[model samples]
Target: MAAVSKYLTAKNSAAAGGILLVLYFLKQRRRSAALNRKKGSANDLNSEKDGKKERAAVDKLFFVRISRIIGIMVPRLLCKETWYLFLIAVMLVTRTYCDVWMIQNGTMIESAIIGRSTKGFKKYLFNFITAMPVIALVNNFLKLGLNELKLCFRVRLTKHLYDEYLNLKKIITGHYVDHLHNFIFFRFSMGMVDSIIAKYFATVVGYLVVSRPFLDLSHPRHLSSSHAELLEDYYQSGRMLLRMSQALGRIVLAGREMTRLSGFTARITELMRVLKELNSGKYERTMVSHSEKDVSEKLTLVPGSGRIINVDHIIKFDHTPLATPNGDVLIRDMCFEVKSGTNVLVCGPNGCGKSSLFRVLGELWPLFGGSLTKPERGKLFYVPQRPYMTLGSLRDQVIYPDTHEDQKKKGISDQVLKEYLDNVQLGHILEREGSWDVVQDWMDVLSGGEKQRMAMARLFYHKPQFAILDECTSAVSVDVEDYIYSHCRKVGITLFTVSHRKSLWKHHEFYLHMDGRGNYEFKPITTETVEFGS
Candidate 1:
């Protein structure tokens, strides 16, 4: 949890830091903009205004920076004991220098046995050098291996960042998922690993360079107790001291930077809490009432078997409920029934409450005046007029709601999937790399008409009985639309369609209509002797 706190705090610091960076960049841009405007006009007045804004932006940036340090980086330092060991290993392995130290030293013979004279030691030293590097490498490499143990330390911040990334990729909806994934997966993990490896390797090289001076000698025969050698030793010792000082300074700075990051994390968390208040306070609510008073509440009584999804009594746009001002709900009395194997068409006109009705039914919005009954959350599939596609293999697109193993269990093979794609005219596109679950800027690749067809392919793959398609096939050609619908019909799928293409109306046997007066009348357009093109 401390690691999570650390991660959050770090993220917070980054966010705060970003705010600073943005403000600085904006200030610079504005200054330039003002200068440009001033260059032709009166400079004094505009300059004063630009100066004021720049100063304000600078002040905010400074405060945000300070907040990042306190909120993010400080907490990391507080809990860094867990991670210090690995970093220390990185330091130790990087600084090892026995080989470099031995490179220039006096006669190889003396080194083999400490008391032997410098020239006599040469033979043994030659033998030792060949075998010693192996032991030295192993010993030093083992110390570096200690780096693996560091992963065991588990920084709270790193884990939290990962969790946030995971939850985002797995559960959260809307735009931020892709953006956050890019940052956490690429920037934090791979980027940090690269930077760290480079610095440590540089330190290792430095050790090799620094150790070279120790081997330089004056008059090799008189290895000890000689004035010339002593002076030379003194010069080399001074150089070593200077190099060590420089290395020490660098270590201090690295430590300080880590501290800064830690502190920045703390300040970031402090500020971030304001943003994360929504997430950290997740409270699972138990449905309180077994029975609902109004149709709205009644909708809740069914206990949706597919997903324990939340349904609200009011749908608000900005703070106002999207309803008729007369307390006549744009969606007055409504019950949403989505059973598996049902296809629902959500239809209405330019503000006749069709999209609003689907929005309410799909659980995206609240029923302004009714309660909703739903199955398990995430079970019901909603295909909008313009469906969203991700960048992935073509396989991913066809197998969306990817969690449901039943499709595979039912022996829905590649052949079956391809047949479905061909029905929707997407079979040709499948051969394109990554077309299976292609997450391209597909919004661009496929024309508006093709996108709707692709949505149908997604719908067919999931085969969720209960689907609310709100003009989902709007842009498709009438024939393609007929093919998709006819396929659904052959599959005996229950459907609720909302479309103005009167050609599509006969596809649904049951219909619910909402009047502009904010009251919905659910009547049986239902005919049991179901006939298509009726």
Candidate 2:
């Protein structure tokens, strides 16, 4: 009858498990269907497809990314603070030993109780009591130390990445700025805050609630006839419960650590990818002058490539075709150049290659199928329609890409910075913001025209030989625009400006007009050639 009852119980358990499996399968199917619906929806299908492609790419590079991340961390671990890591290792070993010792002493106590050896029971109990507090103290101390070490490591990693970001000499695009936030999030996760909290918090709670109950279950009973059996059964039950709780705690902690680690890895890998892009010279644009020698040499534009071709009287483009980064040709076999001191006005309808032409000149875009000449990087400057407001004092904005020390060496002073601001009619900002040294969020505090005027102030401060002002004065009044151009001309800053304003032609000597259909015209802008569509 007992065997029959056991078989019935086993069958019931099996049936329950089968029902659970079916439910789990249905749940998973529903989840997959929901994901498919999101992926197939009209509004999000294209974005979902792109996300899938990105995911696939990430999967392909996951192992390489992991290796790179490890490569970054391992060196720090083995640095001068290597002793700290060894101490952490020793602490972990001590923790494991304490756990094993506790289990062994626990079994000994149970045996002593069952054998009715009062002396043995007392000795084992005293040993357990002595070791428990010491072990707990050591464990907590080690955890605190570990967290501090992790924090130090995170700081070092963040500083290294910041140095890399600063070393990149390119314009800070909006896309790069967005990724900068993601990179900071990655840095914060590097501390493994979740794992630390889980370990300490769960351990304390497990000891308070779990250990107290186990102790209650294992408490000594009155000495009686059934004392040995009763004590033995209770001891065994308490040991099983304690071990089960510890195992479950470890599993939960491991799951949380793994989840945080996965997130940290993804964010770090993406940040590294962006850093690589920022450091690369030719990402979207093809350099017509890139040769084995030039690649091996410095990253500057080659003299023949597009910086200085004075012998030809103008920087020539030999059958050059301009294309978008995606390889769609915008202007084919186009050729033009402005010599030193010759100001050119780039006029075209919206969506034409006027701005793109400046991009090519700025070396921010690739010049395809043509060799062009441009001055060395520092000799040229670009002021976009929406100027970049760097994070610093008003002086920093004007003399950006140049440190205060560099400017000092170049004989620039606070007085000079203030003068440049006055040149752009922004000298009032000095008083409004307190002084040139008073730092503020200039982008937010300054209006649109004020920002452009600040950019012009920067231009006047740098005094580059050639400046590409792409509708930079669109926000300023006509009078202000005239003043800004007059300042540039007075400072001998040759202009390659893209503007629809007819009032700007008087400041330029030549015009390069595009029709947005791979057609362009380049000629002297004289009295008869100043009208639109001319």
Q: What is the C-alpha RMSD of each candidate to the true structure, in Å?
A: 15.9, 12.1
Q: Roughly what TM-score does model 1 have, to 2 decimal places?
A: 0.42
Among all windows of ten consecutive residues in candidate 1, which has the lowest summed lDDT? 298-307
Query: Which residue runs of candidate 1 sit more than 4 Å off their true CA positions?
Result: 1-371, 383-394, 401-407, 430-455, 468-478, 489-534
Residue range with the least summed lDDT across 10 consecutive positions in model 2 = 299-308
lDDT of 2 by residue, 9-107 (tens): 325533643464455446644754676666556536576445443321223365667677756655654573466667788888888788778877887
Residue 408 lDDT (model 1)? 74
lDDT of each: 0.52, 0.68
lDDT of 2: 0.68
Model 2 Cα RMSD, 1 decimal: 12.1
